[model samples]
Target: MDLYIYNKALALQNVMDTYGSLRWVRRYTECGEFELHCPFTVDNIRLLAQDNIIRKKDSDEVGFIEYRNVKRDETDRENLIVKGKLGEGYLNRRIVWGREILNTTYELALRTLVDKNCINPTDTTRIINTLILGDIGNFTGNINFQVSYQNLLKVVEALCLEAELGNRIRFDKTLKKLKFEIFQGLDRTSSQTVNPQCIFSKEFDNILDQEYTDSIMDYRNVALVGGIGEDADRRLLTVGSGTGLERFEAFNDQKGISNMVDNVEMAEAEYSALLSSKGNETLAETKKVQTFENGVNLNSNLRYKVDFDLGDIVTCMSKKWGITIDSRINEIEEVYEESGKEVNIVFGKEMPRTIAQKIKLL
Candidate 1:
């Protein structure tokens, strides 16, 4: 035999709130329950299916299912805790239960002032503006403000059409091309310098001209280091292993050296200020700031605010309440010897009576 339990009162309230009508089902269970013994009809099965609450199989059962008292489930308890923590769950649920209360009362009043002259709910633009700006108070004057599903669909379609037509024109034909004559020359010179047998130098009569080639190559390398052309090579040259000019060029291109020089100057100024102070306190403070800025980029909101006091409080609370509950359950298992019990009590019984109860008290 199959058994099912549902909150009839909540189900009725949901139906009434959605359709604004009471639907009576003859074969289904009610709020306060009773025992029964008979097979239900296909029409009764169809009614349950319509609400998406139950399913029926082609089983030839001989006995009717007993009606049980309606009660809230675990999802309801979890939702209660979530609402309580956020301070909005209770009011939202109250609104669901037909209690008319406005959370953003002041904002609604401001909306009423702005929407004094324009109060057309059926207008797609007006409906969209209200939702985007959260101005529901202006909708009070319009009887159709309580939007039907069909009206929402219409509003979505209108917005989508507007977005689709926004990018109709393209202007690639009128765009200007960047000049690259200087960069192209630099690339040619650098290629010839690296490989003396390149086609450009091969055509020259005095191809053994290392002096002329070296001068042009030096200029090309400098321009390349300054981000001039596509073929500008950026290979590093060691100081002791090469000529002074070559080593200087390589050292200049090494990344982050300029930033490090600036940081060093700033640190020196800060250290001087600290020395002028009575004690090492100011110096320590300045060092801390320098260390933080140098080691961390503090641009992302997540990374910047990660070490805040409020975040620590939330983390501590989560560990204590969320994780500690399981710890306490394990402790209970250690204390309470299950072997002595007469009845074959399952894990479900221990969960609700022991662990869940302890968690609530905590």
Candidate 2:
């Protein structure tokens, strides 16, 4: 990918003609952000201080600048964090500012992402309809969502989780649209397989590096979810268990509700889902592979010729590790630089629980 700088009017300012990279990461269950780093120059510094924008472009994707960092004596170049145009609405929301969305369906929540005027009274950006996908289903739920001072990206992620769906955004060059795809369970179906011989090890030219990680924090067998209704005195509790005492996690959702019984029922169902989702303790692996092949580029879009994508289940046999990794593509990081371009892929079923989701409600 190539990085370019643009002015407020969206005119080209500078092309990243120097040595650097346009870095980006995509997450299956969360939002993804972009970054650019190149040789620092006085003009770039001035642009950073002004209304200048940084963008990344390739055969398939595009990114818009959101924040910039300059490294003078400390480093060699300037760096910028870019957000895909599709993400502008979500990233702009304040974490502390919360909004209450009530009586809405899954499709409407998604519409809020593209239809700025529908969700935010002040947003003016045009909605891109071609990029939207998936059905919102028939059930409508009330969200006591606090504009929460949390940015819209995270807030919307939580909303999707509550609805038992997966959310992701990607740039589709064929359609020339920033595609936002939502799935009911896993993101994609696995039709590809990676054998031990295909993996880069001390033997393979395509494999550059690989790392494996395992954690118990992701394993939760017993989940206790509690909530309170409109009346402070009214309380509800639900417990979902998978195994005996391996670990116990509790969630106190204080999102206001009028009915305690209904809220508790919802909490129980959510707890059961959460328990089933996170009930795993296994070795997770991340792989980094070379982008060059016989002087041809392969690690970008063509790399997926093996057929793998975010939330897709794939079988990976690593002889060196003596274990087979069969899981979802939770996250992927792509790096482009003058030295060479490489693709970093991470595999896992679910992310570790965050403190925000575990917030205790009074």
Candidate 3:
């Protein structure tokens, strides 16, 4: 597989068609990443430095190198290991300026956040001239959310996941800018007859290897939100209202969430709704995770991208295990090595892999 290299400025650089091994991963709810191992050569070393960009032809996932290391085996063989996160992670570099309460379609809310902080902030010093919002999202659903002093990427991702949506920041080669967009996957499950269904089942000989996990260890469906004030007088709200054995409650402290927007004090009910919105978003991070991972046979009737792609909801069943899953294609991994190319698919959200994700579990 050929890989194109570019500077962070989008300038064309070296291309590395030969590599020891490569792991390119794409995700729906989070930024994608890539790990590349290549022969230790002067050109490779110069091309794989931090801040450089790597991309695969015809793929929307573009990543910036963040790490590079040289490895030497006992036999004195040397190779370079390079790793990076996708351009979407650029949001991680920014933070919400202050308290933000959005009560509009999530599509516009997400764009407004990026626009205010990165593209065209009221503070001219914060403007990223080359970054622009794109017209890529059309999901229609009102969301009342509040966030303050938090990482921009994490907030946007949480909202997207709760809304059953996805997002990306694609490099506009000709325009020389990064376009941030929100998107939702198509429904391709067998339950729907309108579109061609993409099913992967052991019975069909397409699922090569499979592991299924259903866990509630980190799941909580109810949230008791605490707002400004003290004791019983404090503004309190609950989201994901459930009761009895069905209730899985957690507490969300949103004292920083102000009842005022743009210097005007909002009505009590309106402020309560905003508090509940923030609580709901916190609860969303504790959703029950039912993830499926497996090797896929590309030669099977189901073709990658053509039949189904990342973010598409597809059905998966294992008659042997007596479990069936209808979930979004949350992740796709492409591996390139000397032997050949291989693809693996991950359905549904997997366990939290980063410190930020793990903290939410606590």
Candidate 4:
């Protein structure tokens, strides 16, 4: 078989052997969409066993260690086979294979760090920093250092802040803003003079100029909160309804009307109850029912007029009218026959062209 396929088969068997059953393993091989158990085939089982990928258990008789469903009191033989197949397929896919390799590389790095004593049980931050930067000089100490978990977290936070500051300095060139001047006198009697200038003064000035220009443009566009020419009181007045002085009084009247409606409803209900008590039985059966419907109303109209402007009169009398006219020569006809019209032309040169020819088809 292909080397890749063989390796995947072996990997699936190994997973099954490690977990004591293919069904229980978190990652295995599948066929269609990538699952965990597509590799354990009849022909490859013996080969996998020889490679120690699949382990055989001898309990009275030699048998493959299969996953058992404890709840069902049955062996998960089909799931085990399916998982092997899925795992094999996953190994075959190139992207999945690359991801697995990258994962293994990181795992190897972690393992090396642990073995070399660069990472301790408590110092997770130092471990991460060492792994990323490949510098463990600061982490060298006794493994049994009496440090609390919170202290280790603090160290991690401090290291992170240091890294962030270092990155900012590297990218922003903040350190370059600090200038150093060295002055020396050739003779004992000689003197030197030094003058200093602010490095960011020009940059700050440019920023302010741009901000002022932007503010002017914003004011010209429209008034908004925090923008130039914005009237805070006018904006507040126009916020809702825009009725100004009348809004407050109208709101109070509306509240009063609602209260009156509620009171009237209550009184009517109480009167009906009193009537029922007085043996007016038919009044108790009467009840009000309300229904509501939502809909949209649209209206369209077209109006035509003749214009008599001085410019139009001049253009009509002028030798070279100085106007280029667009002619839609085609006519729209609503053809009507004795048996009613079979077709109607609504728009430009209408022969009902294909969708590709329609400009507004979308």
Candidate 5:
């Protein structure tokens, strides 16, 4: 597991000097990050610099150096701890301006979002000419997206997660640029016969050290959307339907979603539809944390990235607890240390409910 280090210009500098450990996290819906601990030495300090790039061969993500720390241990050992984020994290440098994408191919909609925010924006000076949107994939369905003054990275990740898609930023060596791509994982679930079924369970002795969570502390099913008006005259609509305990209610304020647009060319009921779409989108983004955290057996017959990869939907069962669920592999953390390397897969993202919990998660 050699880590390739590159200069600020994306040119190969040298391999990371062996030292402590490297914890590289990869995600399906959003940009991932890493923390590398190496011996504190002149060579290591010079090789690891701010704005330099780090990547592993045969991988899509290229991490951007963000923070570097030097520490001296009790044993008189000095070490350098480096931290950074994946390439897609670069989108954090820009914001999503006022835009409404309605009834367009999802691929085109995504490309348009990136083009306007990263490349060829209305504000020419904000353009990142080197970032190119890749060709479309086999994605179908129309999208209605309305965003104003939002973080581009969060918006992109939310949309991709809702749509069950994967996003990446690959460093194109030949083109000397970053290629932004949208992809979907294969359906390797037990019920899907199209490809080989991928199931992880204690029965098969493939799943280990499980930590499952099933909580609805933040779940909501129905949204009572209020757009514009006052008191009894307020415009209102319902996004989802349910009865009794099945109805987890939420109130959505769509005051910014106007029923009227300044231009006459705008279609009728478009704003209303946008408001409804917003409600649905919000609901979809917020869901119960019924996910598990575990690792795969390295000696198992099943192989990663070949039979299953990030974003792939698969079946996981716990015999002791008698719980089985089909979920996506949302994240994977690779640990490389003196003991060797191990990969931990997160079936679903468990959102922390408290500030302290969130900080602990980070």
Candidate 6:
């Protein structure tokens, strides 16, 4: 692994040989991010800034696709920490930085973020075309709103939630573009499965430890949303809807979805999505596994190698814990140090949407 810093013209600026540690993280619901800790030398400080580019190279392959310096810190003036996000740092850029979009298709809505050269002002051809765009329905009667100072990523999340179609948006580091994918479960045959013992050798264990958690917090019978409109001097309206969860219990939740829509129809649509999506599911379980190489090289062969990515479904078994999970990879965090790299995987089933996700209605 190697770290390279570059200038705006793509010129080699600085390289790190005695860095502290490097971390790369991937989340199912958001963009991946990276941080580099290195000595705060004069040469390194000169190459580090808010707009400078950083690249993590694994052999000849680009590990993070791309990263931009969004923040810098020199706590003791001896070691510096640079923090940033991946794929042009779209999350750090405000929605107001992009072009205005109104009542557009889901595809166009995403395109507007990158089409107007808002993501990267210097490079227009950096975004790749291997996007997994999903349908967001053909309803032209969608809500109307404007982009203020919110980040591009947050806006996209709200849009996906409002679409209410299991839609997801992520920055594909390897593909070098924004990916709009909808959850369609997993294709079992193509997925890699990990067990307490390796598939090739039961003598060599792959799982070090495991744990399980179950929750009913997502269960709800009613989803009530109330918000003020543009012409409101006070609370304008309240809308309540149910998903027929009387079988479970008389559970109810209230949300403030204010100043986000232009009319009642759009507001109702938002409420319906919330009720239908949040009420039907109640049982939630997550399985965390500590493994070697993240179960990648455990069963490798000439023709077969096991690997996993965000949202990929994999099977895990822990005889000690008495748990067998065929779950989706929800989060991944990796740490690289002088000793070696540690990759931690979190697997879960049935994740509930949060209030922050209702930004689409706003």
| C-alpha lDDT values of all predictions | 0.18, 0.44, 0.80, 0.19, 0.76, 0.45
Tens-place lDDT digits, model 1, residues 1-362: 23231121112111211111111111100011112212233333332331122111211111112222223344542111000011111111111111111123222422332232123233334421211122132222111011112232222222212111100001111221111000000111222343211111112221211111001121211211111122334332221222455431222232211212223543433322222221111111111100000011122221211222110111101222222111111101101112221111011111222222111100
Tens digits of per-residue lDDT for model 5, 256-356:
66555455434546656666776777677667777655556757767878777777888877878888877777777777889887776666643432310
**Collision count of model 5:** 0
* TM-scores for all predictions: 0.11, 0.59, 0.91, 0.14, 0.90, 0.56
Ten-residue region with minimum lDDT total, candidate 5: 353-362
What is the Å distance of residue 7 in model 4 from its true position?
A: 7.1
Which lDDT value does model 5 have at 348?
61
Q: What TM-score quantifies how close candidate 6 is to the native fold?
A: 0.56
Show model 6 residue runs off by greater than 4 Å. 59-77, 96-108, 113-150, 158-204, 218-221, 227-306, 318-322, 349-362
Candidate 2 vs candidate 5, lDDT winner:
5
What is the C-alpha lDDT profile of model 4 across 1-362, one tens digit per residue?
Answer: 01121221223232222222222111100111111233335544443432122222310101122222222124544322312221112112111111000112222322232322223324343331211122222322111111112232222222222121110000012221111111111111112123211111112221111100001111111111111123442211111122443332111011111112223543433322222221211111111111111110111111001111000100001113222111111111222223332211111111112210111000
lDDT (tens digit, per residue) of candidate 6 on 120-164: 434545433333343443433243433444566776555543443
> lDDT tens digits, residues 23-65, model 3?
9888888888889998899999998878888888867568999
Q: In model 2, which range of ten residues has the least summed lDDT?
A: 353-362
Error of 5 at 18 (Å): 1.9
| Candidates, ranked, TM-score | 3, 5, 2, 6, 4, 1
For this target, which candidate reaches the highest lDDT against the unseen true structure? 3
Better of 1 and 4 by TM-score: 4
- Candidate 3 regions off by >4 Å? 209-212, 291-294, 319-322, 350-362
Model 5 lDDT at residue 168: 84
Better of 1 and 3 by TM-score: 3
